[model samples]
Target chain A: MKDFEALKSIWHDQVALPKVSHEDVLKNLRKTRNGLASKLLIEMIGMGIAAAVLIYVWIASPFTMWTTHLAMIIFICCCIYYILAMISNYRRINYDKLLDKPECYINHLKKYKHDRYIFNTRKYKVYSIFFTAGFILYFIEISFMTSLWITVMGISFTFLWIALCYFVLMRIYIKREEAKLEEMIQNLERLHKQFEDTDQ
Target chain B: MSKEAQFKEIFQANSKKIYHLCYGYTGDDETANDLMQETFMKVWQNLDKFRNQALISTWIYRIAVNTCLSYLRVEKRQAKDELTDTIIETRGEEISEKNEQVSTLYKCIAQLEENERIIITMVLDELPYAEIAEISGISEGNLRVKIHRIKQKLTELYNRHERF
Candidate 1:
């Protein structure tokens, strides 16, 4: 009983709260950037969707009217947005930048596991709904020569997205493997620390 | 409330508990501190997705455990343990007076496999076996059995080291 009491006291006294501050926001931002596989997967899905959207539009009679032209222009703009998203991703990868801004990180990680959902949902968005919708739109605009040209351009851009995704994935895979190796080393180090503490 | 206010409340309430959880796993004050901050930062970032099913404390513990586990993967425990010895030495009287039993308890704890250690820690923190089982994705009955074994082992270890 005395021992139990003593142990409890020690547990309380020795265990102090660690001081964690806002930088953790940045740290997590860094972690997202560090998650290269996820990023690549997202990019690939995005490209695949763009391609399917193009094909769907081609099949659906290709819109050429002034209204269709405007709509196609909007679609192209969305495509450009997707492209810009991909480019930002690449730049992030290149600079080793993590999306660690405090507002974004806190909102994503703590406000609700928003990041996890976003992380999980990104694949579906790129590969399924977005792609399907995009292709259908493209086909509607297909009657327009301008739409055809845009579709062609979109296909080319899709290829670029795929190439970039592949490149990023390869790099991320290597980093992930490296991180795994590092993890193993850390475990061994902890064991060694425990042993040494015992010796002391 | 605005985002900043909400974030601040979470940081204040959970930071210490999160740190202790990390320390319980890492046994390093500084690393545990860093992990605690990281865990909260994650919680803050993912706050919106928290459907109120589980208690906030449970969620925080989950994050702390995962973070510590991942960090452990990269660190060389051997090197850190050596440094831990130095820390223990420097803080000998401070730690020893606190109760050598706790350190002994932790040493044995560190010996358990990762899953076992986590389950036991959750138990020690007074988390119900049901919650433990839920977080671990195991049956409550199984958790009871595992907890019994862990306690038995811990008792045996505590006795073994008590004589020294």
Candidate 2:
């Protein structure tokens, strides 16, 4: 069997050709700069656009009932709240700076995972409740303006959409996200333990 | 020097070693290539923030280490032992007998524990022990002991693979 010193000499003797070029990396840098729209950023922009349209409707088509005005306020608040939360979460991840040691990075990731779990479950539930209540209030005025069948259809669609989100989409999303996060955390923690084990 | 020019020089000097480190970790050329690009992408993004406290090589190694460690996000990690056959099969047609030995060495390295894989690769690359310890976040004393054990284990693995 070849000894460790011989193995080291063999390791040094092997040549490694560059698979990726400098130009390729530069091109990727430019491409990333131009196309760096994160999911959170997209969500923020969408919520901003929705809020703008809501404000336009509030101005152009005035509502008679106080409930409609209150609903508009609630809807706008939800959009703003969601956008802020996303921004906060985005900042917490610190996407630009990744210079921490492995142990520190693992801890940072664990904290982010815990925060996401709370946001996805508890904070999401509160947001959904407020959003649904806003829709119910808006529907009270909607019933008076539209025909009974139209109002019924509108409420049915809205509730059905919300129900689908709460029961199906949200459950699946949370499950997938949590599983990914858990796996990542477990892997990092195991690596961290390996480092620790060497010290002992 | 311009940042781009500096970055090009850094990439030229370090990319080969970084690829080796990544290949040592994953035992797959395609994945190692992707990871090397990812590590350089990060270095490009954060070049301005790099201080003069450490050797540029050490800093880059740290980034590469973190990049490899975080790679579990992209796909499920293949089991360590299963990696050898997959790598051999992927490169079997193109590799010379000498390169086949290199491939076998990588397969053995892949069977190591995650941190052991990183430490041994840096050792194989002939990095200074102090820098390896710093990059790995362990003391030099402990790193030496760890490297000694890893060397023994790797020798065992390589001999076993050769026997087969």
Candidate 3:
């Protein structure tokens, strides 16, 4: 190999840079800050819809059965729990936080990745179960009012939607997310290994 | 000078170095630009917090290293087609020999570990051992030892690539 000095000179000599003015920097900073705010707003909107549904059903529905009330409460609590967990995890992706010390960054990424995996694989199952169970209970009371055919169709559709959410929709999302995190972790581990290789 | 004016002057002086540091890690212009800007963005945001206890160059280089490492991602592979198109359109019909050498150097840099890349880049840029050690949060003696091993590996990698 040529001397490291030669390589250093080459690095120093290569100075081609695309023009980036101060205006560009300030504009992009504002854009990035807005982008973050919009992401949080979108997350809140999702939970807002969930909460709105909870209120609409609880207040407007005439079904007075104890099972219906219990099921609604279960669904509400689950939504709240999911939202809280998502918000807390969201903080991990902050630009400042992710750029902590190298080892700490890797550790944070690993824990965040693991928690996301659980939220998809395990937590989703539990979530589906409770939600499905709640719907079944709600449907039972509705079965009293609707015709037999309508009741059967309604129940079938509910279960089918839940099945699609678990087996198809959520699965695709989980796989994509997990793969992205895995790729990042692999890069970080490679970087960390570089240091270890040097030290040893 | 006002803080903003000071920052612009600093950026004018060091933006190229920061860009190359990023370019060395990613081996691509587009990603390097993104990382460089992200690094500077952090500097802008945290400029008030910089107490001047460390050399400004060391401090900014650390930020550049951490930013690039943190944002290293694989999703760009999916955009390979568009990236190729962009590269061709920008570079035009001729590829210079110097450009190839620089590209080869960066590709070699990409082979090293993240910390090694950051450290070696600092060394190549000729930052003093004391300042490099200060920013790296390592002692100068340990840094000297690490730098030796890192240079050896980089030389080996560079030779291995030259053979191909």
lDDT values of the candidates?
A: 0.56, 0.83, 0.74
Top-scoring candidate (DockQ): 2
lDDT of 1 by residue, A156-200 (tens): 676566556545764576567556655545554554453233223
lDDT by residue (B1-164, candidate 1, tens digit) is: 86667767777776765655666566666676667766766676567766673476666666665555546434446322222431233354655644455566667666665556666667666677776765554567766777777777766666776677
- Chain B TM-score for the candidates in order: 0.79, 0.88, 0.81
Off by over 4 Å in 2: A38-45, A92-97, B73-95
- Evaluation by DockQ, superior candidate among 2 and 3: 2
Q: For residues B9-121, write the lDDT of model 3, one tens digit per residue.
A: 87888887787677666666688778888878877777777777346777787777777777746655422112222222235335555566566677678777667777888
| Clashing residue pairs in candidate 2 (N, C-alpha, C atoms within 3 angstroms) | none
lDDT of 2 by residue, A1-200 (tens): 87888678767756655579978988987887666556556787899899999999998986999999999999999999988887786566444435677666667677777888999999999999999999999999999888999999999999999989988999999999978888888887888788779889
Give lDDT tens digits, candidate 3, residues A115-199: 8788888888988999999898888788888899999999999999999998899989988887888788787778667656544
- Can you tell me the CAPRI class of model 3? acceptable
Better structure of 2 and 3 per lDDT = 2
- First chain TM-score for all predictions: 0.28, 0.85, 0.83
Model 1, residue A118: C-alpha shift (Å): 22
Task: Supply candidate 2's per-residue lDDT for B130.
Answer: 96
Worst 10 residues of 2 chain A by lDDT: A89-98
Model 2 vs. true fold: TM: 0.89
Docking quality of model 1: it rates as incorrect
